[model samples]
Target chain A: MAIHALIFDVFGTLLDWHGGVAREASRLLAPVRPDIDGGAFARAWRDRYQPAMEPVRRGERAWTDLDTLHAEGLDGVLAQFGVEGLTPEIKRELVLAWHRLDAWPEVPAALTRLRGGFLLAPCSNAHVRLAIAHARRNALPWDAILGAEFARDYKPKPAVYLRAAEALGLPPGEVMMVAAHTSDLVAAAGCGLATAHIARPDENGPGTGEAAPAAPVDVAASDLADLARRLGC
Target chain B: MAIHALIFDVFGTLLDWHGGVAREASRLLAPVRPDIDGGAFARAWRDRYQPAMEPVRRGERAWTDLDTLHAEGLDGVLAQFGVEGLTPEIKRELVLAWHRLDAWPEVPAALTRLRGGFLLAPCSNAHVRLAIAHARRNALPWDAILGAEFARDYKPKPAVYLRAAEALGLPPGEVMMVAAHTSDLVAAAGCGLATAHIARPDENGPGTGEAAPAAPVDVAASDLADLARRLGC
Candidate 1:
């Protein structure tokens, strides 16, 4: 069957959420902590994000929307950074910054090119608003955005991929999941979707080995531009 | 509370499915039947579309997908055109062509711009494949794509819109339904969604008088770009 669509993993694939989140956090914190290192603050803020969500992701707690997760994460970051007396309003702003992260350099052009042939979509963990805001901010041309919120769970859950394909109205086989994280691809692949890995050298540190493992990928490229070419779109 | 997202009706709003279908049918018929006006055949094909889908849309029939509706419409179009010797494969090709129609000129840029301010999505009658294909063909940047296949009913139905908001993890009021057709927006409005009208000149035709009527619209604009500006995005 023809590869009718390419569904992306958004968090680290199209946009660098970690860097963006930190930068926005730092900017918001600048007015309050004139002497605070925004860079370090941003990083610390991001560090708390996942750990905060782990309970929900692991189902130890009931599913929480990212907004709630972000709020909790922000509070911990403020405490850890020794930034005192941060109001709930300011914390909310900091949490919302996740919606304004910048797109990766390769994103806009690669998405445009791929849109020429395949239906370019995203199967992301970001909530619907967050995902849409990120796409609009970066001008990433997505045909349709799919989020974990759509499935009521985060990825590497099979429901996310299966629901995405069902929403796209294509059975599992015709949809290809393009992701930087191998685990996400493995999950999509488990649902019978073809998988493509777009390598991100900057992600997960030099030795993190967080990229999806090699065997699961139907196609792998160094960047989105190369990914587009490899897909022959 | 602010309306954070706008979900659109695709067929007549962003893309002129009727116009495209008519154009393609005419082009296809030109060489073989020089005397036969293909435009009339195209209109005839589209004319049959909604009427045939009425039973399903009205809940008289068990829920059906667009592909089946298109097939039934195709059968009527062939008979009206008096075209003989149509094979099953040729009919299938024509039915699938509905998935590939071109979007309006203002669509891509308008959506790209509006997408900046709100979570822009599609609440469409088309299946996911058709929706994604139309977006790819036209570069329509959607945050999420919701199709009738997901709810198993066509537009003007509350269940479809309700299911969409539920999947979005949102309250119906926070999600706006944007469309050129007033009926879809009216239905969405009844479902407690904020409604916006992106008035397309081409969408205002004789048959559409039935679809467009005065309704309490939350926002009305000439197109998505105008909608974005008015929304202060």
Candidate 2:
């Protein structure tokens, strides 16, 4: 069967998470802690993301959605920065910052083009609610939301990729995983799906890293627009 | 919180399944069984739909998506009508007719309006792939595909409605269930979700049955456009 669907890695692939999170943090924390470096705070919070999910992935902890994990991680980041006295409601609003990330400049148009020829969805580690909020905010034209909640596990766990493919009623070979990260593409390829890499050098910060795939991939593009053109969409 | 999401019952509510299936049957069966009444044949196949799901719902059989159930039902309908000798490839093509359904005339515009104000998805009995195909063909703007596959069970089952709400991280009362079927609304209400009814008088053929709510609902409208207007969208 030919490739009929394209599942994307959401965080750094479609949206500019670093800028969005840092902006939200600045806006939210400015009133209480004007001296805090919002960008540093955002990075510190995100740095814990992988470790937060490890327990669930290892089956040492029961399944929990990313929203809850983000909330827990936010508390530790706040304490690490010596910030305190925030009300529960304020903390809750801040933790939902992930849902408000803005899409990269080329995303909406690229998605609209690719959608003409293939099914599109987010195969991210984010929970369903987070995915829905991001799509609504960014006008992402996804056919469906497939992620951690649907599979009850995070990505790079083979179950996540397999479940997404199964949900589309396609063999792994008939689906392509499109991402900026090599590890995500590698895991997807290991599950028999095709892989495409789109670079996002600023995903971590300028000059800190290049979003090139560490391993060879089937296709490499400068961005989603280039990917769309390469795919002949 | 106010209702933040609206989950729709797709088959009769958004898409004209009756007309779509009847037309596809007429086109596909014309060469093989010219004497068969396509509309009646379509209804016969649909009539077996509920019965086919009973075993899975009852746990007597393992979970199977609607596509497989529909295929099995197609076989029985073919036998009942004395139609035979369809090649496996032809049968597969015929089974996919469900994915090609056209939306009721008002659906796309109304959904566009609704999508502006609320998160939207299909809480249908269809499988995930079937739902995605229907959305693409009909231009229905679903935020996510939540149906049988998500719950691993068919609708009218409390788990289906509850799980759909849970996946969105919203309490039952914060999600509204919109449908043309009274049974579906009733089940959703039982799960503590608000219900809205949209009349689809021709769902079972004009004048044969009215798609009125069997019990009181939060709101009622003649069509999706009317529903969107009533919701202040």
Candidate 3:
């Protein structure tokens, strides 16, 4: 089947969330808690991401958006670092760090090219608000923002991929899931969508992310530009 | 309160749906039903729009997307016209006329100017798929596709406005609802959103649509360009 649209994993695939979060955390914490390590704090907060969504995924909790999850996780991370006396405004600003992430340089130009050929959207765990904020800062040129909130579920779930394709008005076969993570690709593949893995060698941190797919995928490229080229964008 | 975003009423405010639908209906039916009046057919089809949604709007029926609604409406329209023998493909193509509308000439440039300072989205009764299709055809620079499907309800219902504001992650006061219709503007204002009315003198047909607000609006303009100027875009 012809691929008519590409639904993306925003955090790892498009934006440098780990670095952005680390930078924001450091900028905010350095003035108050000199001993706090921003990288460690970012990693610790990220570590709670999937676990936070687990309850919603398992139906153990009602649908909760990522903002709440990040806010809750931030409290735990701040406590884990023994940091104190931060203002509520600071916490709110810190949670918004995910929205202010820098794109992975080549992503925008490649997206400009790809937009000419296919409908593009972010099928991420981030809600529509975060998607708009991310696109505003990065100028990502999205046709729409899809995934989590529409599905009311998170990644690695069939609903996210299925509902995203449905939202794009395409069958799963005509919608390709583009991500840096193999788990997202596998889940999309299981839903009959095509999959592309854009390698992000440092999505987690420098050298911590995959330089190649950890599992089978139909297409794999060094970055979004490479993926665009391979897809003849 | 500052308006951080502008959510549009896609059909009349941004797109020339009546003209586009009339043209499409004429193009298809002129070759078949020689006696059919395209404008009348377009008006008849649009006349069904509100009533079809009444059951869904009143909660007498489950949520139904516009495509399904339009398809059903098309069946009634064809029968009403005493026309028959349209293939399923032609019927499907006819239904997609809603997705292939031409934007009002000044709307895009005005939108481009407005986009620099505020996020833009279509808060139409349109579902995500229809929004994507409309945006693809017009290159309307939407930050996200929002409205009906998200609210599981149609316009004039407070849920649609309230949920769209929630999805944009802003209070209703910070999001301006822009429409050519007083009903939509009134509904949105009741939900605490700021409202702007753009006069579309020919939205329904020549001299048929509103040349000015029939009800009070926060701002009223000759067209989208005038609206942009008043908004300091």
| Tens digits of lDDT, candidate 1, B30-112 | 55565666556666776776777689877799877778888888877787777777678767777876876788777788788
DockQ scores of the candidates: 0.45, 0.85, 0.83
Q: Cα miss at A94, model 3 (Å)?
A: 1.6
Considering the two chains of model 3, state its CAPRI-style docking category: high
How close is each model in CA RMSD to the real structure? 4.6, 1.5, 1.6
Q: Compared to the true structure, candidate 1 yields what TM-score?
A: 0.77
Task: Look at candidate 1 and give me any clashing residue pairs.
Answer: A168-B128, A182-A212
What's the lDDT for residue A103 in model 3?
95
lDDT per residue, candidate 2, A154-221, as tens digits? 98999999889999899999899999999999999999999999999888688554567789899999
lDDT of 2 at B139: 83
**Can you rank all candidates by lDDT, best first?**
3, 2, 1
TM-score of 3: 0.96
TM-score of chain A of each: 0.88, 0.97, 0.98
Q: 1 or 3, which is superior by DockQ?
A: 3
Which wins on TM-score, candidate 2 or candidate 3? Answer: 2
| Per-residue C-alpha lDDT of model 1 across residues A1-233, encoded as one tens digit per residue | 46777888887788777677767776778787877766577667666766776676788887677788877777677788778887777887887777878878978988999988876667887876677677767877666667576666788878889888877777889989988888788888899999888888666346443444556578878888998888786
- For candidate 2, the share of real interface contacts preserved is 0.86
